[model samples]
Target chain A: MNRSTGFAFIAPLLVLMVVAFNLPIIYMLGLAFWDKGRGFTLEHYEGLLEAPVYLRVLGNTLRISLIATIANVAIGYPLAHWMRGLGRRARLIAIALVVLPFWVSILVRTYAWIVVLGNGGLVNRSLQWLGLTDAPVQFLYNELGVTIGMANVLLPFLVLPLFAAMIRIDDRLLQAAASLGAPPRTIFWKVYFPLTLPALAAGTLLVFILCLGFYVTPAVLGGGRVPMISNLLDTLINQIPRWEQASAISTILLIVALVIFAGYRRLDRKASA
Target chain B: MTSTPWSRRLLAAAGIFGLVFLTVPLLIVIPMSFSPARALTFPPPGFSLRWYQALFGDPRWMEAMSTSTIVAVLSSVAALVLGSLAAYGLRRGSFAGRDWAEGNFMSPLIVPTIIVAIALYLSLAKVGLLGSFVGLVAAHTVLNVPLVMMVMGVAVRDFDLRIEQVAWSLGASWSYTVIKVMLPNLAPSVFAAWIFAFIGSFDEVIVTSFIAGKYETVPKKMFNELILEVNPTITAVATLLIAVTVLALAAVTLVLGRAGKLGQTLVER
Candidate 1:
């Protein structure tokens, strides 16, 4: 296609980006610098730095996201490897099942967890049923619930990339290794594992970034108790109506996401090279 | 593919068990929604259509459903048009900064939703668009465009443009060539993109919670209720949504399966 027409085709998307994606962010960046109470000032940033609550929330957000990301990667790798070993039909079934939760609404998924982990819900009842405990478990509305729900929602993000990497693996390499008297475990460690690193790295980055920004899962499952950055920002923007502090928090989140994204690209290039 | 020894067997067992872990919670919600009891208990005492009946009996649930459908429908359409054109350009059109352009388009997915939400909320407030249906639709459209673009770009790339060139040589206009020759081949992919966009818009809560206020989308309303009261009604909604999701996924999978590029086709495409 000619340059003019090609540019024309891309124009609508660029317009969309400018209006919806880029412009809002630019607007928010401006809001971050402005004080909601008075004229333009650095008070928002100062408050963010000085306030112990904001610092604690930021720490909690990072800790929770990190934990969830690690758990997802750990679980996703083994599952992806296992699925890769299955026959075509079984692999498809396995993947579809793994991804089934992806189709559920975020709200619904969190709600499902509430029912599963609530005081009067399944886990508590099951524990009692099995006579393992007399009392119901304190599962929901805590850090533990937040971690489980977030990890569950984001598992597919890890699995898809890891599974994709596994499929790209050449069977010949494994066969050659085996023929060279390498045991299955040895071949997996030396051959398959290294080859899958790029995807694992990619999946980890993707999940980490995603988990960091996850708001609803934490909010619903965290029960206003475990305040993540997103939840804090939500309160500022909605309840308190402090646009500047909210903007600052949001700006921090964006910066972290960008750093993670840049790291992902660097790792991806190294892996490919 | 030849199977391995014990490791393979172990991997298979682990994989199946993980699948059960992933799916059982969602599975439980379905039967729980059908239970005669109002409270959720595992191994549901008895199955009945009480919750389902309540869903239909209540006007608010129906209204929420309609509102969700409206938002999804409008956003998906906008995404389909804008995304396809952009994807077509980036794929077929040789241009400088094409990689940058594609990445820019998909950046919405990577950017923290809170950032997107805060920005949109502020921007909408400036333009007198806050709490407006149009604002919410616009946000969702922006959010969904990347997905549609990704899918359509794949479909367009795999498409043989030689046929379109031939049609053009036979005196067909560019639009006509695209419509008659290119579009039929692309119809399924386009439809799939539409479904994905629809699903994405419908299920979204984070961005919606920020953008949507008193003008409540179903998910947003459910979120409000969830924060205030943990009830079986949300379970009922979850059940209906899960059922729809299963059905929709089955349809999409069948289409992708028939296309013979089920897994990779979605991502790379």
Candidate 2:
């Protein structure tokens, strides 16, 4: 079989990707540099630095991502361990439970949180009924709600990789340690924990990068009062129609995410080495 | 050995708590959709089908659904063709720049979708493709083609080349060999790819906002409703979405569990 024939078959795909997929990204980077009105001004990039708002939002986005990553790790590690211990059928069911949310629309998942956390929602009614509070606690329209929502949406992401790593771990090692008189905690910390660090790193990298670019979750759950970088990008585009600024922020976002992801890749390589 | 009993119990409780945390909010939306008060309240004041009626009655929602379906169907088909073709081209042995192509092709999966959306918006606007139905299809194809490629890449790798060889030896034409021998083996994965691509396009809100000029996808409409207005009918729509999601995941699970186990077998090379 001629590999050239294979190239002929794939040429359309490569062309389509180069044109529609790759070109647009390169185009966006171009737009960031040369504005239509200003003829290649750094004003937009400068604005990002000069404006405290962008910096604050960037810092805050990083903070929230860290918090959510921590939450996911805390919840995901045990869930993965538990699923690893399950029988085959039970493990499949558990896998499905984790994947169902992944397959669902982000919009639908955010709506679900709204229903539960709304002022006239289950939590408020429960609090009121139990005489805990006379009023709704304002769960929605805040950072806490956004964190909870992000964690719920991202939990499966953390768990899946962790589960994969856990399942591949040899049980005999644990038994060996046990027979050698190592306690359960000691075995877990020394043997199991070190092995799963790679998965944890991968999951955190994914979830954190995703969190930084997240628009819908924070916007819907944050009630427009809280602004992440994406939320701020929306304002500049829709309300102010500042394409230059929008492009600038988006470019920064793209680069920051890529840089961090690249950094993680290097760290992962070094750690594995 | 599992663990100490105390640790085992603790992990089990955490596992249960995690599952509930992930699933309960999604389930709670079902009853809220039926709330007669047009607001989300616990133990809903009463149950009624008014929200569903409103959703079925609304032309705007219907239009959005129709648009999304048309866009999804068109893009998924396009993605399947383009992606599968690409997969068929690459053999197991590495080619020069295969690593670069592989990484770049899947870059769409990384690099924030918002960036993609914005970039596509700008480029399409330049060529006057903004908000055009064709633009939406093209943008969506870009989003889903990589997924299709990833899925079909596995199927192609696992495929028995000997079967394809027999067809060739029997003097089957190129198209006939592909249509008869190769495609049959690829059918399960093709279907799975189509569903994933369809769901991705259908549920896409961010990218649609950029190029879907004058068009409203169901998710984009739902976003507007979520942000600007509160409607009980949106709840009804969401419940229907949950039902669809259940069906979609079921199909995915079945396909993945079956023979070949395409996605389960291979990953990015």
Candidate 3:
């Protein structure tokens, strides 16, 4: 097809996307400068920086995301290594199992954790049953709860790429490494580990970026106390209707996540090359 | 050789632990729904079907379910149409900016879903389309198209174009050739894409939370009920969800079995 005709054919969807998807993001950016709707101003941004609550929430989001990312990568690496050696049938079953929770709603999954970790929950109940504790321990509505909830939600994401990368590695190369007088530790450290780094890095970036934007997990599990940027935004919108401040915080979040993701993409391309 | 046994054992233990970790929440929650005890606890004093009965007897759950089902079905069908056309166009027609076009369509999959939800809610609310079924369907279709494209792209990647060319040479029209020669091969991919799109819309909470404004889908209903009051009915809904997931995955496994054998056969050449 000619250029004009091609553009014509695709124009409808393109216009729909621009109007339906892109405009609101642009509007959000526009709203960050609102000064009581009379004139454009940067008061929201100034408030965001100056407000201790906003700063704490931003720090909390970053800290939680960083911790969850590390936890996911730490768990995902070994799991992926083990998955690589499994037979085809077993591997498929493992993958399906791992991805099962992802198919379920995050709201349900976070609630499930509440039942598992709450006062008189499975863990505390078990501990009491075993005579390990005199009282039921409080585990829910805290940083620990947030981390568990976010990690469980994001674990599949980290595993999928790592599993895919591991599956792509030629098994014979491992045998070759073994034959070349490399110890198992050396072979793992020098050969297998380096090969999987790209996937590990990709999965880490994916999990971290996703965790940064987590809302429901923190909201439900944190009991509206331990605040992240999402919970803060939720409050700003719902409880107070501070649209300007909400818009400002959201724009900051969007920019930070996009910049990190873009950086990861560049690193991924370079690593792959 | 010495390390082999230890490593294997550790791996087996890890695998089992991971499996149990992934599944036990759903498994425990499902059985816990049937507990005669008022509070949600690990072990039940006795068993009753009160929660399931409540779920079935409630009109709200039924309404939410029907709404979700309708939205899911319509959106998946819409995605299949638009995504299939776009996939076919890109696969068959080479152009100067093919990569750019592909990137544009696939960008939705990469962007954070909250951003998409916010963007969509703002635009729809402005046009008074918010909470309308058409708006939901259209939004979900756009979100689902990238998944369809990915799966269909895989299906069409290694297909021999010359088969269609040969049929056309024998006087078959383009549509006939496609329906006869190409579609049968693409059926599994299309079905898989449909499944993904359906599940994407069904499990979707972030977007639905923002846009469902006044109207409640099943997930939204569950979200509200859970926050307001923790009920056995929520557990019942979760159990139902797990059942649906298992059935869906069973069907997927069967499809994968066929696809796997077909792939191995093709790879032998």
Candidate 4:
């Protein structure tokens, strides 16, 4: 194909993306910095710093995102490692289990946690039946519920890539270590674990970035008790009509997410290579 | 590594627990949807489809369903056409900024969806298109474009260029060659991409909630209802959504499996 025709093939989408995607984001950034009469100001960011509520929400978002990412790594690493050792049929089933929920609506998954963690729900019922507790434990409308929901929803994001990277590990590498008289533990820790580290780090960053902006899960699972950054932005935009503050916060979040994404890209390239 | 029996058993136990933790919510929801009682008790009093009945009987729910379907169909088709064209160009073209263009096209997937929602909400409201259906469809198309591009980008790259070259040498016009030769070869991938985009738009909640104004898609209504209170009717809706996803996935797997692209599509990226 000629160069012009090649450009022609992409022209329609390029136009659409520029007008709809890029421009909207740039306009939002402009809103963050621009003032109605004064031309430009940092008043919106100043407002965010002045309020304790904004700081609390920022702290909550970071703490929750960190916990969820850690939980994902804990559960996902073992799961992916085990999957690497699975038979073909079993591996396929495991992948399906992980991927199915990923494709489901985030709302549905978040809501299901309510049913499972509610007063009369499964976990509480099981606990009470086992005589571990006299009453149902509070798991909904709190930080605990929010963290668990976020971890569950974001697990596949960590596991899938980690598993893919795991499967690519040549078994001979481990066997060779074993042949060198390294015990199973040493072989796993020294050879296998290190090999998977790049992918693991990449997946961890991806999940953390996702958790930072989580809205629906926190809204439903936390029941307005846990105010993450996204919920704070929602309140600023919709309830109180503070667009400038919301834009300022969103600008910070976008920059933070992009920076972490750049790091993830580097690790991901190394993992795949 | 699998030699140590006790360690292997421990790993297996943890892996099974992880899988259960991941899928138990879905399993619980499906059974709860069929419960005769209103309470979310797992072992129901008896089997009943009352929730499904409620879902289908309510005109509001029906309207939301139709709105979701229309928006999904329109946006997915738009995404498929535009994304496929762009994917073809990005793969075959030697443009100077081709890599940059591809990254820009894929940025929507990387940027936090909440940011996308707020941006669109602000910009659309600024332009007085916030509540418009056109605006809604356009947003969905943009959001889903990355999905279509991912699938079609791989497909276009893997497709042999010599076939198209032969068609061009035989005096077939570019459009004729694409329609007759390229489309037939890429049909499986095209179908898979369309299904992905459709599901993406249909299940969209955050963006739809922000910008849809009074328009209610199923997910939007379901989310609103969940926030206010937990209704058993949503269980039915959740189950239905799961069913649709499973079916769509199965269809994609079957088509792409026949084309021998399933593993590559699923695992490679």
Candidate 5:
């Protein structure tokens, strides 16, 4: 095929993307930086700085994202490690379990937390049944609830990559380490851990990026009490009609996400390489 | 190196806990969907289809269901056709800026969806297309393009260009070669890509919620209802969503597994 045929094949999609995706983003940047009469201004960004609400939402988003990402690492690393050690059939089942929720709607998964963590829900019920507490614990409509939901929903993001990396480690290397008289703990810490570090870092970055932009979980689980950046953006665009400020905040988020994604790409290449 | 027995057991316990943690909520919701009572309780006093009845009986929900289906079908088909053609071109053509074009196509997936939502909301409102069905379909098509591209890109890259060259050498037109040769070999991938795009569009909430003014897709409605109250009717919706996802994923896995592309498609991302 000639080169132009290739370009022809891509032309339609390019047109659609430019019109639907690219132009809109550019327009948003224009809205953020270009005022109607002022031509170019940082007024929207300055407005963001002037409001304590924006700063509070930013801090809340960062803190919640951090906690969620940490929870993902805590649960996901061990899960992936365990899957790496499983037998073949068990491994497939484990993979299916992990992959299933990844494909499920984020709304469904976030909603499920309500059923599981509500005051009259299973966890509290079980806690009460076990006599661990006299009263039901409040797991809904709080930061803790939002964090747990986020962690659960994003766990597969961390585990799948980490597990793939763990499976790629040669068993012979471990055997070789064992033959050299290294203890199991030492072998895992010194050899295996370092080997999976690149993938772990890449996956963690990926999950963190996802958590930063998380909208549905925090909205459903946080119940408006805990405000994340996405929720604040929602209020700006949908409720308050603050389009310029929303665009400005979105620009900052887009730049931050892109920068972190670049980092993820570098680590991902190293992990796969 | 083998761990000590106690440590191995500890790892096993932690791993099981993690799996349970991930899956228990979904497992709980499925049974709760069948509860006889109106409350969100576990292990219902009796098994009843009341929630499902409530879901199917409501006209508003029925309207949402129809809307969701139409949007998902139209957008998924569009994404499949456009994305596949682009993938074939990117793989076969030595075009300038091919890499940049491919990256731009995939950017929708990488960018925070909320940003996309806001951008589309602002731009669409400016153009007086906010809450319009055309805008909704176009938005979903854009969001789902990456899913189709990811699957088709791999399929096209793996398909041997020599086969197409042979077809061309045999006096076949380019369209004929694609329709007869390439389509046959890439059928499984096309099915998988369509399913993925369908699910992606169907389950989408953020973008749909943003620009879909006066429109209620199932997820958008479900989200609104959940925020206001925990209705048992939503349990039924959640179960249906789960069922659709499971079946769709099973179809993808079976087809892609037969094609021996499942492992690469799942893990290479």
Candidate 6:
């Protein structure tokens, strides 16, 4: 194909991106710095630091995201490792089991948790049936519920990458460690764990970044009581329609995601090299 | 490596627990959908398809489903066209700033959907496109194009363009070469792209929530329903969505597995 023709073919996507993707983010970034009444200022960015509520929400966002990421890793790592140990057919089945939830809508999955963990819901009833507790536990509409829900929602994200990472890990390395007098636990901690760090890093970064932006799970599970950055950004834009504050939060989130993404890319390059 | 007895036990128990943790809630939704009871209860009292009937009967539910289907179809088709073009262009020959150009296209999947939500809202509303079908399709197309490119780009990478050149050398037009040679060769990835874009658009909620305005897709309708009250019909909707997902997954696996790229194909959506 000729140069112009090739460029012409690519032009539609470029034009659409300019209109839909690139311009909107630029506009949002402009809104962050552009004040309607004052024309232009760093007031919104300054306000993020000045206001305790914004700062608190920012802190809450980081804290909750960290917890969610940690939780996902705790759950996903062992599962990925186990799948790695299984036969090929069994591994595929295990993977299918893991990937199944990614098909479910985030809202639906979060809603399902409300059913599973709600007062007088399945977990509560099961507990009652077992005579473990006298009263129904308040699992939903709380941080624990939100954490569980978010972690669960992000599990596939974690496992898929971890599984892929582990798939690349040569068994010979483990054998090398074992033959060199490393015990099973030592082999895992030394050879297995170190080799999987790239995938571990990749999954952690993905899950953490995702958790940082996650809205539905935290919104539904938090029951409006807990606040994450995404929800806070939503409240600023939707309920209060505070465009400046919302833009600031969105910008902060964009920066955080980019930084971590860049960091992960660096790690990935090193791992691959 | 032979694991210690305690280690084996630990792995077995944790594996079982993880699988159950992953699947039990989904399984719970099935029975809840069939329950004759109104409330969200487990071990649902008696089985009935009342929710299914209700879902089918309700115009709002049906409208949402149809609207979602329309958006999903229209957006995916557009995304496939545009994304394939971009993928082909990128793969044709290396260019300066090619990485930068690719980054712009893939940014949607990485950037938070909420950011995309607000961005599309502001940009679309500015041009008098918000809440309209045009606006939603535009936004969804943006969201799904990267998915198409990722899937189709794999095919583009694998299939040598020399055949297309040869076809052109034989007097076949560029369009003709692409249509007759390239497409058939990359059919599996085309199917994969369509499936990803279709399902991605269908399952999209956050961006749609912001830009959808009056056009309520299924997820938006369900979100609204939750805001009012959790209804039995939602379980019905979820069940249907799950069923759709299963079929879609099966189809994708069948196609992409044949291509030996199922692992890469599975993660995008």
Q: Which model scores highest in lDDT?
A: 4
Query: Candidates ranked by DockQ, best first?
Result: 4, 5, 2, 1, 6, 3
Better of 5 and 6 by TM-score: 5
Candidate 4 C-alpha error for residue B224, in Å: 0.4
lDDT of 4 by residue, B1-269 (tens): 86878999999999999999999998899989999998988666799999999999999999999999999999999999999999999999988799999999999999999999999999999999998999999999999999999999999999999998999999999999999999999999999999999999999999999999989999999999999999999999999999999999999999999999999999877
Q: Which CAPRI quality tier does the interface of model 1 achieve?
A: medium
lDDT of 2 by residue, A104-137 (tens): 8898898888888888788888888899998789
DockQ of 2: 0.67
On a 0 to 100 scale, what is the lDDT of residue A51 in model 5?
94
Which is the winner by DockQ between candidate 2 and candidate 3?
2
lDDT of 5: 0.94
Give one digit per residue, the lDDT tens place, for model 6 in B53-131: 9999999888998999999999999999999989988878565666788888999989989889987877777788888
C-alpha lDDT (0 to 100) for residue A47 of candidate 4:
89
Name the 10 consecutive residues with the lowest summed lDDT in model 3 chain B. Answer: B260-269
Alpha-carbon error at A272 in model 5, in Å?
0.6
Cα lDDT, model 4, residue A22: 95
Write candidate 3's Cα lDDT for B82-174 as tens digits.
Answer: 777677667767667877777777767777777676666655766898788777887888888887787776666667878877998999987
Each model's DockQ score: 0.66, 0.67, 0.40, 0.85, 0.84, 0.65
Q: Is candidate 2 or candidate 6 better by TM-score?
A: 6
Residue B95, model 3: lDDT of 65
Off by over 4 Å in 5: none
Q: What would the per-residue lDDT of candidate 5 be over residues A198-266, giving only the tens digit for each residue?
A: 999999999998888999999999999999999999999889898999999999999999999999999
Candidate 1 lDDT score at position A134: 93
lDDT of 4 by residue, A17-44 (tens): 9988999999999999999899899988
| Candidate 2: C-alpha lDDT | 0.82
Off by over 4 Å in 1: A35-41, A269-273, B1-10, B267-269
- List pairs with backbone clashes in candidate 1: none
- Which pairs clash in the backbone of model 3? none
lDDT of 3 by residue, A158-215 (tens): 8876777777777778889889888877888888888888878877887888998888
10 residues in a row with least lDDT, candidate 5 chain A = A116-125
For residues B115-184, could you state the per-residue lDDT of candidate 2 as single tens digits?
8888888788778888788878988898898788878888898788888888889999989988888887
